[model samples]
Target: MLFFSGKGGVGKSTVTAAMALLAAQQGKRVLVVDVDAKGNLTDLFEHEPVGFKPVEVHPGVHVMTMHTEESLQEYLRLNLRVPVLGRIGPLARALDFVATAAPGVKEILTVGKVCWEVRESIEGRADWDVVLVDAAATGHIVAQLGAPEAIRDLVSVGPVRAQTEWMSDLMHDPAVTALNVVTTPEEMPVNETIELVGRVRSELQVPLGAVIVNRVLPELFTHADEETFEAMRDPAAVNRLVDALGGGPDVARGTTAVLDAARMAVSLRRTRAGHLAELRRAVDLPTLFLPYLFVREHGLRVTRMVAEALGEELGL
Candidate 1:
């Protein structure tokens, strides 16, 4: 099981979806649980939002959303044998209260559900080869993953305590679980990731996984390559190229536009390099960089592109 967390817009959902697809392509049954209320992880596979019930959107990938009510319902039905049977309606508003006052009580509902799926799968009661969680963002992830420890210390002699013991064992086991952070090579995102990494190592029991860097713009040229490209932009060389392609005002404008775009890309990559270096120095974990997609729309098409990139990165 892998929990993916990072800044809200750092493409965390996209990366998680891509990983699900990549795992499916590798013949693994992948279950992706969207832990955010407004999650669009299923949408990346061109499916509409789903409830706690998982929907198999791709060949070997299932997607589901995490709702506190649903998690509680499952907990009662399975753990306590309370037979809720659609009877949690009145307790819905109370969920918010528990979240505010009891803290880990609300978080355990989510994390426990995630850990349940993984344990069931391993024990042969479920069919997931891999469980990927689009977990809470940087601000909330540690608390979410740490719920088991909190509950174990506070509760005694009940299903909840038993749940915590098992979840903690599964979560803390380096072989079974990993928490991976997704971030972009930008100031705020990188800084937040660095801080989150520190917190995870110090405060959480989950083992760290690779830092997945998303939307990276690969440098388009070496210094020598840039010198050659610069020469191509020289007035004389530009004139010759324009004549070679049959010169016209429109052609000249297009040529200038392309050259300017390349120059801007080179500059932008150089600027992001500093942030990437900082992230590397601050976080000692395996890293994978996913190149930026030059697309206007996002859906399964873009998801597949990222999945293919993931396959390459994983040497699949």
Candidate 2:
């Protein structure tokens, strides 16, 4: 089981899709689970996947949406066999109450659905070599992961308890599960990534697979280019440019002409590299760097690029 988790808007869905597609290409049947409330994974694929049912979004790629309410209703009706207090309309209200009032009940139900998928995948009944979960952002990831444990602790003497315990064990098992934290080269993301790595180690005790640094800028300047850039910035160089251009003693225009947009791009690239290096040192995890994608929209092209990056990083 491979989990792509991080803060919101960190391209977890993108990474999950790329990994799943690559896994499928490698002859491993793959299922990409959309566990986020926003259903971002569905958007990455071309097809729409209904909640709680696996849909083939691509060849060798199955997709499923995990909704808290749907999981809760399924659990209550099928597993718990609790007759509803009212009709469908009122059932929604009751579910809403349980979702909010019970605290972590929704989380448990959602996680239980994922646990079912994992178990099914292991049984060889499903045509999936791996289950890729595009999990929720950092804000709710902890509660989501702890859901099985919560249910296990709450009901200690029943079938539900037994099932929850099994799921909890699966989550805590390092051999079966791996968590990858996605981050960018910015301050907020790097800080959050460091904190998340520590939390996963201290709390979940799960192995931290790698820190995926997305949208990293390429270093365009070689050592010779750096020397040229530095020399161009010297005052004497500016004076030479003024003489060469014959710009009537306008040093600002001459200097500005020499320092074009390439200088800013070079500077920004260096700054981004510095941030990435700092994050690498702080986390001490294998950092996979993905190039900055200049596409107008994200689609299979970006997904393929991500897969290539993963392949290079994993040496597969």
Candidate 3:
């Protein structure tokens, strides 16, 4: 199982989609589990998520939302077969409160579902090469990853405690799982990634598979070329930079201005790359860098590109 997470809006879903697609294309039976309530992965696949059932999104790729409430209630009713009043009230009210009342209940259920998937496959009931979970952001991810331990400490015996211990063991097992931290080439996200890595290493002691730098701009110039780009700040030298960059005379004055904009874009791209290289130095894990999209929106095409990049990164 491969888990993908980081700060929100950092292209977590896109990365998840890409990896899932790549795995599927490689003929691996893949399940992309969406742990977020928003069902963004469902949206990416152009499906309206119904929250519980696993829906076939693409060939070899299945999607399911980690509806923790239902999972927990079912876990209680069927597994424990108990008659507890507080957690067994009317559906809506019980679910709402259970989701928000206890801190780790929701997180635990989410992890529990993923763990269940892994166990089912290992038991030979289900066959899958990979389960790619697009997990929640940092704080919640930490709690989710730590759920088994939390529950183990709270419950000493019986089925619930056994369940907790089993989940905890699965998470800590390096052979069955690995984590990928995704972030943009910005300061706060990078810092958060650093903190996240520290927490995972120090607390869980699980080795990260990789740190993915998304929306990266490829290195566009040498120091000398950068000096040339800086010289074009004069506007008078813009034409010369354009000539050196090698575009044709058919470029209208409007086109010249566009070329000037391209130079600025290239410079910014270089700046972002430098920041990414700094991040690569900051973390000890293997790094995968994805290029900035030239288009307006991300969809199947962009995701395919990302998957291609991932394949190259993994040497698959």
Candidate that would win on TM-score: 1
How much lDDT does candidate 2 score? 0.77
* Between candidates 1 and 2, the lDDT winner: 1
Q: Can you write out model 3's per-residue Cα lDDT over 1-316, one digit (the tens) per residue? A: 8899898888989999899999999999998888866666766666676467777888888888877666777677767786654745576466668657665667778888888889888889888779999998876677778777776776668786778877777777889889899999877788788889889887774447889988887666787987776665666675665566665765436556776686877868767766676777878888888877777775676778888988888898
Q: Model 2, 143-196: lDDT tens per residue?
A: 778777766666659777777877877777777788888887877788888888
Q: Which lDDT tens digits does candidate 1 get at residues 1-316?
A: 9999999899999999999999998899999999976767878999878889999998999998998887888788886788667657767677767677875998999989999999999999999999999999999999999999988887777878877888999999999999999999999999999999999989987999989999999889988998999999899999888888779998898888988899899888888899999999998899999999999999999999999988788788
Worst 10 residues of 2 by lDDT: 42-51
Q: What is the Cα-based lDDT of residue 258 in candidate 3?
A: 73
lDDT of 1 at 190: 97
lDDT of 3: 0.79
Clashes of 1: 0
Clashing pairs in 2: 29-129
What order do candidates take by lDDT, descending?
1, 3, 2
TM-score of 1: 0.93
